[model samples]
Target: MTEQVPVTSEMATPRRRKVFTIGAALIVLLLLLAAGTTFLWSRWTHSISNDAFVDAYLINVSPQVAGDIVEVYVREQQRVEAGQLLALIDPTPYQREVALLEAARDVATAALEKSKSELAFLEEDVPLAIAISERRLQIARDRLAEMESALLMVTRDVENGVRAASFQVEAAKAAVVLSEEDYVRYGALYEDRSATERRFEVATKSFEQARAQLEASRARLGQAEAQRQRVPITEHQRDAARGAVEEAERQVEVARLRRIEVDVKRRAVVEHRRKVTEAERAIELAATEVEYTRIVAPYDGIIARKWRHLGDYAQRGEPLFSMYDPDFVFVTCHLGEDKLDGVAPGNRVSIQLEAYGEPFEGRVLWLGSATGANFSLLPRDLSSGEFTYVIQRVPTRILVDRDERWPLLIPGLSATVRIDHGPGDPQWVEEGLRWEDRAAHLSERARD
Candidate 1:
């Protein structure tokens, strides 16, 4: 058997102390590993960003029409409601314009009515007058026909009277010749003592009677010729009747022309009515301009800025005031691209307003597709020689619950936000999160 070595208490104590020191080092290392694991887990469960601010929709109130401001109703930072009168422009000019337009429209309406009445009168009376003229023309034509027939009958009577008078003249001439022959023969016989004185006297008396009869026949012929010449007078009367018919026809044509003129007047009345309508529209436009002289609030909000005052001249599209709704306030944060890996809308978030000194709860409402710098008025050029790669931050919108306590929290307030990336309570996350929860969290932090 090997020689047994003698052991000392000091050596044994040293060995025991070495084992104890190693055991203590191992325990410390295990504790450090556990702490590192916990820290990493916490980091993985939370996404934090300091680049955020309270934001709201800002409205730039401007005038719809140009005018001098007569009254300003609110001061800077004053609260107002929807439809509240914020300012008033000088409405005297617009009012006067509306009045003038109204008067003009009334005048136009009266003119249109007059034209319509005139047209109606023409419509009613013109046709009747034309009918009467046509009837007159027909009567004139019939008169002409009667006169012409009378002229033909007079002409035939004149011809017959002329023939009868010529036959009487020829018979009287034969009797006168016979009487002269008898008178001469009786005178010769008496001279020869072959006839008596009584016989001779009878022959002379016969010759004288024949001469008187011849004179009567010639007078009758002259009278008959005068009657034949009178036939031309009947022809003259027929011509006069023809002229009357032509005149009547002209009158009828004039009546027809008057009817056409009436139709033209009807068209003129239509045009006047259109003018009246245009005047009415002009009056409406003037009224609208008058109404535009008053500026009213569009929604409930506090005035953030006042750009105009009493006596200020406001122009269209010029800002008179600036305002934002307090109840609609939210946080706009720039989330780093690396932090958006698992982030999405509806993520639970905690907001800490530097002004409020409290944490407020909110939920992600929207996520942007582009970086903030990309939307800047002047974006950085990546191709420049001094270009350096920069991490882009995406803009994220978070909706906060309305809280009466934080009524002063408006746009542009500094804030920090932390979003929970771990499994969240569906009831609180899905249904809604209260900003009051942030007040409670503040209380808890204060207690701690």
Candidate 2:
């Protein structure tokens, strides 16, 4: 019973048959591989790490003008719309400046009106003075003419007296001749004792009387000449006439000057009016600046951060709060250098976020404008000074096109990226991730 019969040869026979069957199965499997060829080919694609969080475009909110924070109308994480006021600044200083400008404008307007009145008075005075001066000058000319006429009359009378004196001299000469002849005849008679001696004496006395009348006529002529010599009554009337003429001329000149002055004053009024207008405009401008101090949302968005509150000092150009537009949010990711090869805008991309299970569809909005080497705080400039040949990563901007289901898509999320190389791929990449299926079905569970 203990002789277990050395059955090693019998065992070897079954083992050989089993080996032959195994080898034949392997040959058939190999022949099937050689006879058939199937490929699961697809389009070239790329992917990026993704998360579903609330997304919004960010902008630093600050006031154009600086002032104390008067009131804050919004809180952190608050939703806002376009033209909605978010904060307010103290407007006291701007109000005072506007008030002062308005007062200055009023003063300028009053001064302009007063200048116009003064110009009007001057215009009236000049014309009146000119008329008065003309009247006075005319009177002087008339008086001068009267004096000339009087002088001419006096000259005529003097000439008449001279002619009468000459006539009397001739008459006296004739009478004296006649008296002498008579005396001679009488004396002859007396000498002949036919006439008396007294008759001869009377004849001689008559001749003497005739000569005296001639001399008296000549003396009257001399008196008339002396009276006519004082013709122009002391050059005062002529001087007065000249003065009146000069006054008339000066008044005319004054009138002209006043006209010019009026024009200048009118121009001055216009200039002041323009200044007043400008001051009023400046007041409006300053008021607008005060309005600008109250921050307003440019579009519907959410507040990402609030750096200041009421009573907090905010400097000019300093960001007091931050906001973003949810309608324009984009996903940003960094791609390795090797992965970035041949990548361009419009390339398809998929992202896996923190909370979301699987990848999401996106289009490459743009490649980073500058390499990562140039965008860092201490950018690696490999061109100089201990150059390194390390792989460089570039940030790619992708626009997510999925429906708004969950609110976990947010900005500033970390991600990993993958790309696809399908069969028969062309060089240029395309936008959006192409999936194994076309339906944009919910894959929250399938992603895991």
For each predicted model, how many residue pairs clash, with residues at least 3 apart or on different chains? Answer: 0, 14
* lDDT agreement of model 1 with the native: 0.84
- What would the per-residue lDDT of candidate 1 be over residues 303-404, giving only the tens digit for each residue? 999998899899987989988767667789999988886566777889998987778888886678889998899999767678777889999888786666
Go through the candidates in order and give each one's C-alpha lDDT.
0.84, 0.67
lDDT by residue (275-385, candidate 2, tens digit) is 878988998998887787778876667788998899886777778888766555567666666666556666665666655577666666566766677767997665667
For model 1, state the Cα shift of residue 18 in Å.
14
State, as a TM-score between 0 and 1, how close model 2 is to the true structure.
0.70
RMSD of each: 8.6, 9.3
**Which regions of candidate 1 deviate over 4 angstroms?**
1-39, 168-220, 380-387, 403-408, 422-448
- Taking all chains together, the TM-score of candidate 1 against the true structure is 0.76
Tally clashing residue pairs in candidate 2: 14
